[model samples]
Target: MQNAGDWTRRLREIGIYAVIGAFLTIISPYNGSGNLPLWGAYLYWTGLVLTGSLSAEATRTLMERTGRKFGVPVMLALMSVTSALAVTAMIILLEALTSGRSIPPGYLPRLFGLVWVIAAAVTAVGIMIERTVLAPVTEPVKGASPEETFLSRLPVKYRTAELYAVSAEDHYLRIHTSHGEELILMRLADAMRELAGADGLQVHRSWWVAKSAVRDTRKQGSKLSLVLPSGKEAPVSRTFQAEVKAAGLSA
Candidate 1:
């Protein structure tokens, strides 16, 4: 369900970019001095914008996975550099393929600097639009508790999800929600603390299981596993056996 919402939102963003690209195509910026026809210029700019948007999204996702949180200045610097390189490469390829003309290597440095300025300007416009126009209206209620607000740290898809469990995976947490599962860069101890509002317990050093999601308990060989409503099993460590048993999962 949430996955479908994510896809829908992504498609909408792409559509919005396409519309902007079409308008930029009509304006034909930087094309007046070029030899390409109006239609050719439209195609080139539209493709460039689409590709640039994809590259930006990819960069953001990579940063999230690697837990790279940059300040505004650093973020802007990175975006400017990345956009310039990506957009310049795209334009070079398009020009080479369509007009059989390649930009001289010697001119690339100057071209990159110019494109970086334009990319930075465009990024500013994007930020303004996001803050003033595209921002969602679902703000937190006036009296919402901090515990309830804890979900805000989760990805948009899981923000309102019923959390089932959070398992530690190195520095990342494998979050299990009623709808699905997702990985986030967070510590298990920290996640457990934030999840204090939920009726759950730590069954092992690496695993936290929601009490409501526990369907049963079963012994497999020398290990004990807590069965979830989804039929998935969460292992219980020997150190937590007594506590887990006391929680009424002896079956």
Candidate 2:
């Protein structure tokens, strides 16, 4: 299921990039293919846009994994600059291959500037789409036992135990309960759907905590965590800090 979702997301991204590429081809920005036929222009722009967009996304993901906090504007700027440099090199290579002559050193700076503008625009659009269109839609599970939906999926031993938290680990989820912890082959987003009506909140990108299981809130510098009865702590990311605080889970 996770693999299927991943493929769907990839296809959607490719489709969006392809549209943007087609638009660029129509406009023929910077006279990128002034001498080429229409079909050749389409091929060049589509490939270039797809490559640049993917490169920007990779840089953004790497930046996120660094664990260093950055404002959205700053992160976008950094991603655009990094991707622009990489794409500029690709552009130079492509020009050399097609024109049988390398781009002059004097034109390198201008080329980089053009690439940066396009990179920044595309990067911003991609982020907006991810936050909006690609975000998970969690509807409430209407029933007497909202927790039952997810509890039934737990190991037999933990079916009656109190759920403490659910943390994502690669392709699986680590279910924390009063009895013990168990790993399940499930995505956090899927788990979240089942847990929609449960008395809990997603405290981090990779963590969801039951409200009843929280003993107190812990703060260290700028970091915040929800302390559970079992001595387990669920870290709260900046993105969800406001929701955690509103839920009275913050100190």
Best model per lDDT: 2
TM-score of 1: 0.52
Model 1: residues >4 Å from true position, as ranges?
1-8, 32-37, 130-154, 157-251
Give one digit per residue, the lDDT tens place, for model 2 in 91-110.
88888888889888998899
Would you estimate the TM-scores of all the predictions?
Answer: 0.52, 0.59
Q: In angstroms, give how far residue 79 of model 1 lies from its true place.
A: 1.7
For model 2, the superposed segments whose C-alpha errors exceed 4 Å read 1-3, 137-196, 200-251
* Backbone steric clashes in candidate 2, count: 0
TM-score of 2: 0.59
lDDT of 1 by residue, 31-130 (tens): 5227667677667777777666566656656665664445445555666667768988987887787679988999889878876776776665554454
